[model samples]
Target chain A: MIMLLNECKIEMIRIFRNPYFVFWSLLMPIIFYFIFTKVVDTGVDDQELWNKHFLMSIAVFSVMGSAIMTLGIRVVQERSEGWTTWIKVTPLPSSSYFIAKMVGQSAVHVFSIIVIFIAGIILNGVSMTFVEWVSSAAWILIASFPFLALGVLVGTMKRVDTASGISNIIYLALAITGGLWMPMEILPKTIQLIGSWLPAYHYGNGAWGIIRGQFPEFKSIAILTVYLLLFMVLSIYIRRKQEAV
Target chain B: METIVEINNLTKEFKGKRAVEDVSFSIKPGEVVAILGPNGAGKSTAILMMLGLLHPTSGTVSLFNQKPQEQKVRERIGVMLQQVSIMDALKVKELLALFRSYYPTPLSMEEMIRLTGMQGSELNRRTDKLSGGQKRRVSFALAMAGNPDLVFFDEPTVGMDSTARKQFWEKVRQHANAGKTVLFSTHYLQEADDVATRILLFNEGKLVADGSPASIKQRLLKKAVSFKMDGHFPKEQFLAMEHISDVSEEKGRIVIQTEDTDRVLSSLFSIEMPISDIAIDKGRLEDAFEQLTVEQGVS
Candidate 1:
């Protein structure tokens, strides 16, 4: 357990030191939330409803980017650069490698969630009850797992250069199609149909439900669980197929 | 005496083609054994199997009488593979600390540096920010962090400068002095000859020769019987010998290539032919090793 913590400690340092996280994980989501809510479309009749709704959208956006881009691309880089092979020869158990990445990246996502939630409160004066705030934050944190599993799928790419591109596409597609960028009502029917199938849609909707005095739907939780299992099994299958030993 | 490594019939096949054939050897404690072979000689494949990175199609690799992947076995061994195996953004000290924490009984920072012959000043810099030579030194330091009982280095001197190369072998020698079993693979003939107590000469995917450096060098000396013949030479006589590999004529001299040059010379005296200006040319050791990899690679 001490060794695993040490691994997580180094992982945190590595993630924090990387300039990429600043752009994609932190600054981009917060800036995009402000632009979409305050600058781009501010003429909504129910401004408070819009503020609360967009807050969930951007919160889900932030965690999803961290899970797929930050966690996923780091895995690809580490594996391609020989860190994975190096660890195999060490006394550290193989399970610890994955667990450390999962735990460490989740911690960073927690920070992202808190920061974006703060942005919603201070910037838009969006108010929520304490219970609603805590429950929604908890929902977003737990809902981010499927996307983290998707990140591992990206890590299995044959080349790091291509992994970055593929992961970027996956993150953006889920964000836009899953109604995290805008509500599914504004999107065409075809996109809405596709968005509903994505875990991102249900994850964002689960957070939006808490503020409206509606707990998350059973179907949303079920869909998210299904995607989580799918991503994990797919990533494991691809990884096993690629590796010779 | 107990052996540190016991490999038996270790074979690895990539698809249908073999990368490592049925090769076997054992290493005792305090012996510096070199896996000497040319490129694609399966040295890295064998080492990978021994370290549990590769699976043999049919064989076993035992380190300290346990499976290579066992955690108990892993705790006692250190490996330095032939690649840029370092994490980026972490300072050298952080990387060292992180790797050291993986082992239960790790060497101190100062002791790791001392054993690696490093100056211990590069610890403050990030690993990716270091120069090539500095990165190699830090890697060497990481390999020694566990204060391992058995150290495995796969082509440890592949892309090193003269000073770095000399320092690496010097560090290996230092470890050998402390009774740590060292096993390294190298294509450089002189490296094996200078550093190894025992040499395992591999050709293709098979181990062709195994013995002390002196004895293997003697066998790999590559001798030939050459004579200046004024009349028609009896090439058929030398060609018929099972020991003679080649009989080629060059610049008015008939050269009879054989593993046993004395036999060629004795046969020449036994034949009723005028053989004058006879000389034995002991070719360079590299040529003999090259011959081993090509002519005797199979079986």
Candidate 2:
């Protein structure tokens, strides 16, 4: 248990020391929140309602981004750098290494979420009761689970450059198709259909449901859980294959 | 002597191409063993199998009388691979602490730093900013942090300067003297010659030669005797002598390759040639390594 926690502490230091991780996970997400909420006016008469919905969307986006892009890129880089082989020879179990990464990534997710929420309240004049804010934060945190699995899947990719490129493309596509940038009502019918099948859509929908004072759809939760399991299995399979090689 | 490591018919194949062929060896406690081989000779592959990082296609490896995959066995060993790039963002102290946590008992931080010769400021610096040699030193420090009973180092001094290499050998010697078993792989024949108690020469995925440096040199190279003579010398007479393998003249010196230098010397004195600058050269480990590896290639 101490070893696992030590690994987590080291991983957190690594993440924060990395300028790229800081930019993407903290700065870029905050920048995106400001641009979307404060600068780009949706002209919706219910300004507070628009602020609240956009805040949830960007929060989900940042959480997923950090989980997939930051965590996934770092894993692939470590593999390419031969750090994985070093860890394998140690008494540290593979499960412990992975758990450390998950915990560290979750910490970063919370930071990103809080930063975006502060931006919503300060810049866009968005208001919410303490219960609503706490519940929304909780649901957003829960919604990030599937993306954690996706990050692991991306980490198993062969090359760090390839992993980063693929992660960026996937992050943008998921955010756009899932109606985080625009409402699903505004996108084409085919896009909405495709987005419905994506884990990101469910993640955003769940968080948005919580913000709107309703329980999230059971179908969204179920779909997200299924995606999480699928990605987790695929990640483990690919990682085993890599190790065997 | 108790065997600390045992390998039986170990082999590894990657996509039908054998990386390590059927190879077997055992190491006793307190022995500093060097695995010497050229590139593609499967030195790294063999080390990987012994460390339980790679599963052999056939056969088994036991360390400390337990399977290599067992955590108990793994905890007793420290490893530094040939081509590893560590987390660049981590400070040296943080990296060492993380690796130290993996073992049940580890050396103190000050001891690890001192053993690896990591000085002040270097320990506080991030790994990425260190020079190549400095990074290699840090890697070596991490390997010794666990205070392992057995340590595996693959080309540990590749990027190190001559001074650093000397320090590394000294540390390995200290470890062995303290009853720690070390198994390392290197392309430097001189390193094996100077540091190893027993050398395992691998050629084309086979353990071609295994012995002390002097023994291997004796086995592979005939004694070389060279002398300068002022008077006329009968080269054919020396060449025809028993135990004399070859005789050649260069710059007024008669160089004789022979299995027995005593007989050659006796024959030379009996011939009454005015010999000057008589020098005998024992065969070097490099010659033995070359001949052994070349022989394996031909056969």
> What lDDT would each prediction earn against the true structure?
0.85, 0.84
Model 1, span B140-229: residue lDDT tens: 878888889999998887678777788888988988899999999987766788899999998789998999987787667667878888
Off by over 4 Å in 1: B115-121, B228-288, B291-299
lDDT of 2 by residue, B102-220 (tens): 88899998887786467788789998998887777788878887899999999887766677777888888888899999999877666777889898988778888899976654555
lDDT of 1 at B242: 70
Q: Could you tell me which residue pairs clash in candidate 1?
A: none
For lDDT, the strongest prediction is 1
Strongest candidate by TM-score: 1
Q: What tier of docking accuracy does candidate 1 attain?
A: medium
Candidate 2 lDDT, tens digit per residue, A91-195? 889889989999987876777788888888888778888988988898888779899899989998989889999999999999999998888888999999999
- The TM-score values for the models, in the order shown, are 0.88, 0.87
Quality of model 2 by C-alpha lDDT: 0.84
Worst 10 residues of 1 chain A by lDDT: A236-245
